[model samples]
Target: MGTIRKGANGGFSGKAGSVIGASWKSIDYIRGLSKKSNKPATEEQLIQQARFYTIAKFIMPIAPFVQVGFSQINANTMTPTNAALQANIKTAVVGTYPNFVLDYAKVQISQGSLQPGGTVKAEVATGMLMISWTNKAIAIQNGQLDDLVYILLYHPELDEFLTAPEPPTRGLGTVDIELPEHFLGGKGQLWLFFADRKNKRISRTNYLGELDLV
Candidate 1:
């Protein structure tokens, strides 16, 4: 039943038949009721959903990093995080839909013109995870000495992440991050990139591979 205050011709504010009457900012509106579909999903739809879920789960853990890593592509229509999501969907997903796996090597949490180190590696020492690289920004045409390094460790199984709250600059060439107490015996993937905050630029992510957190 619709509620009419003024008279029969007055605007309504409730359900009448198949449409819903409402108001926003004092503007009257009527819209068709939402309909539920009984049709089963097609194979393509199922596969697409699986890919989306797989990628979303992986990206959500380091969304803050993605926001900055993929910032160069942000536009009036798309956000940085969505841009990364769309990108990984095309290149990072592997295997068939039901078995879709994230190809870590191809996954890029951030994208920019800044050049990463020529060689990036990770190692576990004591209770610290040390990430080191060979390239000095001066050695690369696109790199900057002050470009900040985006280093992070991700436990896909736990959906937890560890990042340098204040990143080290390219000039340093290495950063030591203390692992969490629970991560000591666990394993996770390590990723790093270079970003120039002054120029609004970022580098392709470097997958330093998985490591034992010990």
Candidate 2:
């Protein structure tokens, strides 16, 4: 048929695939017609169609809890509202937002290199997985922020890097980051890092927690 016209529901109704059986009556008749009219679809069209299906089915279902990050931050130089995070305050964050996003997903945070006397914590709805250390300041790479800390998420199934542990929306204390709650349950590990902003010294902490999202 001509483009099979978009559905009244404002979606793709294009019958791009082949029909089953055109000779059979009614149900089978439609299938037959589709099969007979099978035309080689473009790669772009297939990709678009696949993306449409993924959005309509998989991604959209998890949209509600997808934006999970920091909800609140309590510190001397930062609050849930500030963006520029200071290096000298103890910040406590809530897991409510992350709870929603990782209801069933597993994630990990990595701390590359950090400074001393700093601390990092990954607070899931269940508990806190933290890392800390004391000593001289460990400098991040030249271009990297002198004292940089955040979360890192790794996907074992995909054997690839998924997302960088970013700050929650609004910055510092409580920022917003998006995550999918549709996770692969079981024992997943997360890494947290804390960097110290100093010279001639090294400071850092490594914390790992099993992500139990059942």
Candidate 1 C-alpha lDDT tens digits along 1-214: 9898568887788999999888754667799999999999999899999999889888877778888888777544577779999999999989996999988888888887777877778899788988888655466547777778888888777778888869998878888898888888888888888888664877888898989888
Instruction: Please report the TM-score between candidate 2 and the true structure.
Output: 0.28
Error of 2 at 28 (Å): 73
Alpha carbon deviation, residue 24, candidate 1 (Å): 19
RMSD of candidate 2 to true structure, Å: 18.7
Give the best candidate by TM-score: 1
What TM-score quantifies how close candidate 1 is to the native fold? Answer: 0.78
- Backbone clashes, each candidate: 1, 25
Model-by-model lDDT, in order?
A: 0.83, 0.32
**lDDT tens digits, residues 7-108, model 2?**
553222223355432321122223323234477878767654443442233223222212111112232333312211121111222133212122212221
